[model samples]
Target: MKPAINPNKIVVFTGAGISVSSGLEAFRDSDLRSVGQHEQLASPHAWNRRRKEVIEYYNWRRECAGKAQPTPAHLAIARLEQKYEVVVITQNVDDLHERAGSRDVIHLHGELRKVRCCGQHALVSDIGISPQYLGDTCPDGHELRPHVVWFGEQIMHYSETGRHFKTAAKVLVIGTSLQVDPAAKLPKKGRYRAEKLIVNPHFDVADRPYSYRIIHKEADSIVPDIVAAWLEGQRWDYGLGRA
Candidate 1:
C-alpha cells in the first residue's frame, strides 16, 4: 500500500515504553525493582561514591539493550520518513529507533552504548561490550561516565529539540506517561498549531491539556496499524478526487 506521506512536517516524541515490546524494561516496570534495590546505582552521585557499581549497572543495561531489537512501531516511524520529513525526539537511551532505520533521532536522555567525560560534555562515542572502568578517560584525561542524562542533569539537546518542535506541523507522542518534567514537557513545547497524536496503552496526561487521539494499546501492536491506515486513507483520498 502507498504510505501516507503527510505533506505536513512530522515529528515524534517517544519514551521507554516504546521499547518495552522489544524486551527492554521501563524504569517503572512492575517486574523490575527500583534502582535502590538494584544496588542504588545509575546516578552521577552514586557513580561518584561507587564507580564500579555504576559501571556494572549500566553494563547490565547495555547487555540487555544490545540484545533488544526494534519493534514494528519503530519501523512504522522509519517508514513514515519515506514520505515525510521525520524527526524523532526520544527519551529512551536505547538506539532502537536508529536501528529501525529512522534517520534523524534526537536522544534526549543520552545513549546507553556511549560514554563521555564527566568533567566536560565531550563528544560521546561507542565503548562496546564491557563496563567503562575508572581509568576510562577521554583525550583530556577526564574520567568517562555513562552518557545518560540522570535525574538532575539538563537535557543536552534541549534547544535543538525545541527548534525541531517549533517547526513541526504534526507531532506524535507514543508510549509515554507524561508525568516527568522536561522530557514530558517536550511535546507541549512545539507550536500549538501542530496536530497531536498520542499512542499509549494508557494515556496519562494530567499536567497539561492538549487535544489528542489516544490509541489504547501497546505501541508495537497499534503503531504499524495506525501508520498503515493513515497511509492507506491518504492513498485512497488522492486516488479518488476527494483530496
Candidate 2:
C-alpha cells in the first residue's frame, strides 16, 4: 500500500561538504594535482580510454568511504525523522546518509557501493566496500562499471527530485556551495511558502532569486541545533540573518 505524504515533509539537499566531517574530502577540496586531471579521471572518455585507472580510482574511493563514519550533520538530519518526514537529495556518492539512518534518500550522483553492467545499465548490483577489478562482469558477461554519474553523464533522478522540492513544507540545504547545475537550481523550485534554509560555511547568495535563511556555519557545528529546534516545534531562525 502507498503511504500518505506527510504535510511537514522536509527535503534536504546536500553536497560533498556534508561528508567532510566524516573524514571524507570534498571533491573541490581534494588534493588532486590539477582540476583537469580530476575531471578527466571522472569522465566517460577516461572510462573508455583508461579503464584500469578509472577502476582503481573508484576502488580507492570505495575504500575511503568504507573506512569513514557518518558525522554529526548526517546523524542530526536523520533524527529529523522523529517529527517530520525527511527526504534526502544528496549529491554525494557515499552512503553516509543511509549509514546515519535516514530512511528516504535520493542519491543524485549515483552510489559508490554499486556497479552496473556496461552493456545494460539496468543490470546493477551492490559490491559494498569490495573493489571492482578490470575484468569484473555482469551475469550477461558485460564489463561491470562503477555506478557513479561521471562528468558529462546525466545525473540520476532529476524529475523525481524536483517533485519532492515542489511539495516540501521545509527545504534544508546543507553543506553545498550551489555551484553544480540542475541540482543547484532545485532549491528555487520549492513552493514559495515553504521555509527554506541553507547551512553551509562557504555559500554565496550574490544573485539568487529565492529567499533563504542562510546560516554561515559548518554543518557539523550547526545542524544538530537546527534539528533540535525543529523537533521542539520551534523555528530555526533564532536571529540568524537571511539571504
What TM-score against the true fold does each predicted structure earn? 0.85, 0.92
Per-residue lDDT, model 2, residue 186, is: 85
Candidate 2 lDDT, tens digit per residue, 57-116?
A: 888888879988999999999999999989999999899999999999999999999999
lDDT of 1: 0.75
Worst 10 residues of 2 by lDDT: 26-35
Candidate topping lDDT? 2
- The model with the greatest TM-score is 2
Residue pairs clashing in model 2 are: none
Q: RMSDs, each prediction?
A: 5.5, 3.3
lDDT of 1 at 180: 80
Over 4 Å off in model 1, which ranges? 1-7, 26-28, 31-34, 37-39, 205-208, 230-243
List, residue by residue over 109-226, the lDDT tens digit for candidate 1.
Answer: 8898899876655766798656667678888878888988876678878888877777776777888988887777777766665566777877764544475556667888767766
